[model samples]
Structures are given as C-alpha cells and as structure tokens.
Target: MSSSSSMNKYWIPHLDIHKKVITQELQFYLGPEATVRSFTRDGEDGFLITTPGACLTDEQIDDICVKSKEMWEKQAAARAAGAATRVLKRPLHQPVVISKAGASESTRRRRESRRSNETRSRRDERRRN
Candidate 1:
C-alpha cells in the first residue's frame, strides 16, 4: 500500500463543504501538524485527513483513535447546532388559507374590511376617470 494509505489516514467520501471552511476549522481543532485536503478519485469527491504523528508517543495506536473520536464528536455537535440556527433564521411567510368552516370571527371581519376597501377604491377611481 502507498504511504498515503497508511493507518494514519482517514477519508470522508461525502462532505458538502463548498460553502464551508471545514478544513481550516478541523486543522485548528486537531493541531497544526494535522493535514486536511480534498481529492477526487473513482469519479467521487472526497476529503482526506492525515493524522499528525509528530507528537505521538511510543504507545499503542488507541490513544490517537480515542483523541480523533473525541474531536470529531465535538465538531459534529457544533455543526449540528449551527445548522439548526440557520434553519431558525429562515421563517416561512406563506399566506394563511383556511376553509370557511374553520374561519374565526376576526378572520371574517378582516376579509370583509379588505373587500370593502378594494370596492371603495375602485369606485373612487371610476369617478376620477
């Protein structure tokens, strides 16, 4: 296997990052030695993470795996919160439509008032003409 395909590598095959600075954000969390880059292979878009080995001790690989998992969990939770906030910022403004049977008294009054105003305006416009 190639050196780039070692155990220290991680591949994310489906990250939507065109509008995100996820690479710089992750590298900040994972430390300066961490490398994040994009690659295209087999007609698929992917991002790669090369784990930093410069500060690793002579211990087993479990430590790196544990740290990686912790960092990823934190990042995922933050991203989820950001996505929710974006969703909240967009309030739907669709016009309210209802059946006559379900209409309230205030709704009927408002509709009548609007129709009266429209009719009066048309009459005034005809007089002006």
Candidate 2:
C-alpha cells in the first residue's frame, strides 16, 4: 500500500466547518482513503482534502459542485426571506406621504392648524409683552 504522504491534495474553497458533525459528514462522503484538512487565509477559511490517485471521478466532482451551488442558493434565499420579514416587522424610520398633484385633505388640514397655532402663539406673546 502507498503511504499517506504520496496522496494528491485537492483544494476546495469556502469549505469551512466549525461543527464536528459537518466534518464527520464530509469525511463520510469523501470515503476512507480521503483526508480532509482545513485552513484560513486572509480571514477566509477553506479545505484541503486529499485522496490517493485521483479517487473522485468527473461525475462525482460535477455532482459535488451542483450540490454545493444548490446549498448556497438555499442559504441566500433563506437570508433574504429573513431580511424581508424583519423589514415588515420593524416600524418605518421615516414615514413618507406621497400625493399626486396637490396635498391630501388631511395634510392640508394639518398645515392650516399649524399656521393657526403659530399665529395664536405670536399674538399671545405680543399681548404678554
């Protein structure tokens, strides 16, 4: 049998796993001869999985790539859904009132009331002085 040192290294990017369960899953999928190693570079983590004599066939590689893409897409969709729910739950930071052509009746009434209050306050101030 060939030594472990003679095995070929295959680098798979963005395969960082913190959980032992995930590591076990990868190991199980990769088969017994494969050895998986993890590394971090420039704040990003990746995996370096080794196999003897190109153990993975082209079809296996294609399947792995497809599954990885599907997983990422699902994760992205979930995050987007969560963000949308959060946006719906939270109150508006700035309430926007959009009207076409002229102001609405309620808006006009509010402006008139504000003007009357300002006039009354000024008049009261003058009378006091």
Most accurate candidate by TM-score: 2
Clashing pairs in 1: none
Q: Worst lDDT window (10 residues) for model 1?
A: 54-63
Predicted candidate 1 versus true structure: per-residue lDDT over 20-110, tens digit per residue: 3445455455566567678766878876667744322324233444555666777999999888866544357645666555467678889
Model 2: per-residue Cα lDDT at residue 46: 70
RMSD of candidate 1 to the truth, in angstroms, is 11.5
lDDT for residue 92 in candidate 1, whole number 0-100: 75
Q: What tens digits encode model 2's per-residue C-alpha lDDT throughout 10-48?
A: 765554233233345454566677766676656677766
Query: What stretches of model 2 exceed 4 Å from their correct place?
Result: 1-3, 11-30, 38-47, 87-129
